[model samples]
Target: MAVSGGIAAYKSAELVRLLRKQGAKVRVVMTRSAMQFVSPLTFQALSGNPVHSELLDADEENSMGHINLVRWADVLVIAPATANTLAKCSHGLADDLLSTLYLAATCPVYVAPAMNQAMWHKTVTQENIQKLKSHGVIIIGPEQGDQACGETGFGRMSEPLAICNRLMDETPTRCLSGLKVLISAGPTREPLDPVRYITNRSSGKMGYALANAALKAGAKVTLVSGPVMLSPPVNADLISVETAAQMHAAIIGKAPAHDIYIGAAAVADYSPMITEQGKIKKQDDQTTLTLTLQKTRDILAEVAQLVNRPFTVGFAAETHDLEQYAKDKLTRKNLDMIAANWVGRDLGGFDSEQNALQVFWKNGQKNLAMTDKNQLAEQLISLIAERREYERGNKNTA
Candidate 1:
């Protein structure tokens, strides 16, 4: 474990304790300025190992300690990685003990950044982050929250337990290998006119994360996405759609050949019964103008009713009675699984970077607590794969 200088340096102590509690043998290395925030003794006590802070300590370096540190580590994790540390590591500068280990370490490196929102958004910092990612560093959260700086956009380190869980889940098995996955994502627009439409704030992050996870698990992935600003993940075929009608048609056309179908899109429930050929002219005396609506295609229910349907997953974003509504939808639509989350809140749904999911099947249920969409997606995919295999076993026996 490496700790860099930041207000979040204090949090690293707890992180070390959490890692050790999880049976990880933790050896902590701190930046010089990090010692100012929390003494090296704190980490040493928690990690149960000598804290390394400098590259020139003769007692520790008598046996090429820097190289030895790199060799001893199975995985290197840097929490509270400040802007300076990120810049140094990104540019391959090995000026300090932590940065030196970053250069020398052969194992996978994970970084959790902590800084002010402004610092994180700086062009140089963003470029450095991208460079680190390009070099295969697993960049974890700078999750959105109230930062120590008292301003919040997205520059807070993830909580210690979340980081610990991710470390445990990082090396998951390729459980969905050789399967075909079809996923729907983003909010489907219900157009009222050429420029006006009804849609939810579904950012599509959850669905995109699922697609990426399935691809990582060696599944052939096809993502049918509604309008979103996100780029498509590599190796997954992307089909872009706009309106609910178009999304429904695309899914219907392509879902039959896939082995798994996940309808993560928040498809519009209704569309205008009569669309105006042109924008309706405003009348000076008009006080109320009413338009009728008709139900949009229920894509999940349609897929579920197929005679040779794929293993289908649905998502329900609810504002009230989350689990009850989710279970009702699951049974009513006859879906293989349903992942539900509460929307219309300040966090953990819709456009937020993190979310919690309550997954439901017929006789079983699991709660995936709040975390980044990527980790949540990985867990969801793994659960689906496990259930799919279990069903297969039961079918063979029957």
Candidate 2:
């Protein structure tokens, strides 16, 4: 969603690209004032959706035009939400399609205010913004800095990508909001003293994506990361752990009261039962040694059985028999939902940016097709919201 009326309107195209890249469907609406700076085709090409610019068109109004588009948005985003558009919306003046939709919307509306700095500080504009917010519209940042006008201050429309990024990462769905969510990512090194260790093929992409997604959906995220070069999501309470023991310690201490636990880290299933205290010698040609393998603590199951357990999500990576193994894990771990994937596919489960997931709950399932992890995260978050609400409704009725 974009509104045009300021120079910042140009950045909206980049925002559309980012949103679409992340697998979000974007539709754009432009105010008449916005048409002065950019053409509708520019956005149409970027959004891949028709750029809707006029409130009344002979080709459109005959079809009951704006009212049709009015109902079709998961969220309404307005960039460069002009003073005129803002006043109209805040005042409930349905003189235009955009304003009319503002009044009629049943979904969230996010406006990125962009205007001259002085215009932004005006009492009338500020009050109108307050009015819109009071009525439930979201106000994304109009970060202060340089502006297209010679002078600069507050009133730059956030770059289009920034607006979508904020929407995806910070809009409070409470699907995981107000809940302490602890997740781990990457592979841990199991040390046999200070000189030797072991690890796995987990890149932590899936886990980190989950953390980012969960945080975006409003969860307080705690990410216990292994020694991967991955940067933890912004705002995640990050704890860097090096070995299975350290990871276990972190989880044991932090997992108890968590509202949702996603054990997506590919923790080593086996550790050397007897690790030599120091580095082993380069022995003779024919030498045999017996080493015992022991099971690490089952993190997901442990969290699932806690006294006041939160909803639990699990991940299963499989080479074959994906459904059988995933279903088994879901029941065995007492997970509320399990996202399963195949490792040997072309998608490269360990390090690829794109992959597919088969998400399963009790009686329902969804297939997340090959796409960027970020987009899949969005779909997953939306599902999480629906599932949580549905369960809540059931519990209340029962």
Query: Candidate 1 at residue 262, lDDT?
Result: 96
Task: For candidate 1, give the lDDT.
Answer: 0.87
Best by lDDT: 1
* Ten-residue region with minimum lDDT total, candidate 2: 130-139
Per-model RMSD to reference: 9.3, 15.5
What TM-score do all the candidates reach, one by one? 0.65, 0.59
For candidate 1, the 10 contiguous residues with the lowest summed lDDT are 130-139
How well is each residue in 209-267 modelled by candidate 2, as lDDT tens digits?
77767765668889998887665565689999987878988987888777677788888
The alpha-carbon deviation from the true structure for residue 26 of candidate 2, after best TM-score superposition, in angstroms, is: 18
List where candidate 2 sits over 4 angstroms from the true fold: 1-174
> What is candidate 1's lDDT per residue for 1-398, written digit by digit as tens?
99998889888888888888888899999888998899989988999999998787788647567788988977889998999999999888998899999988756578999999999999999999966754446788989989776787889998988889888879556788899999999998887787787888888888888887787676899999999877676568999999898998999988889999999998989998987778878899999989899999899999988877899999999989999999999999999899999988875898787899999998999999998687788799999999989888998999
Q: What lDDT does each candidate get? A: 0.87, 0.78
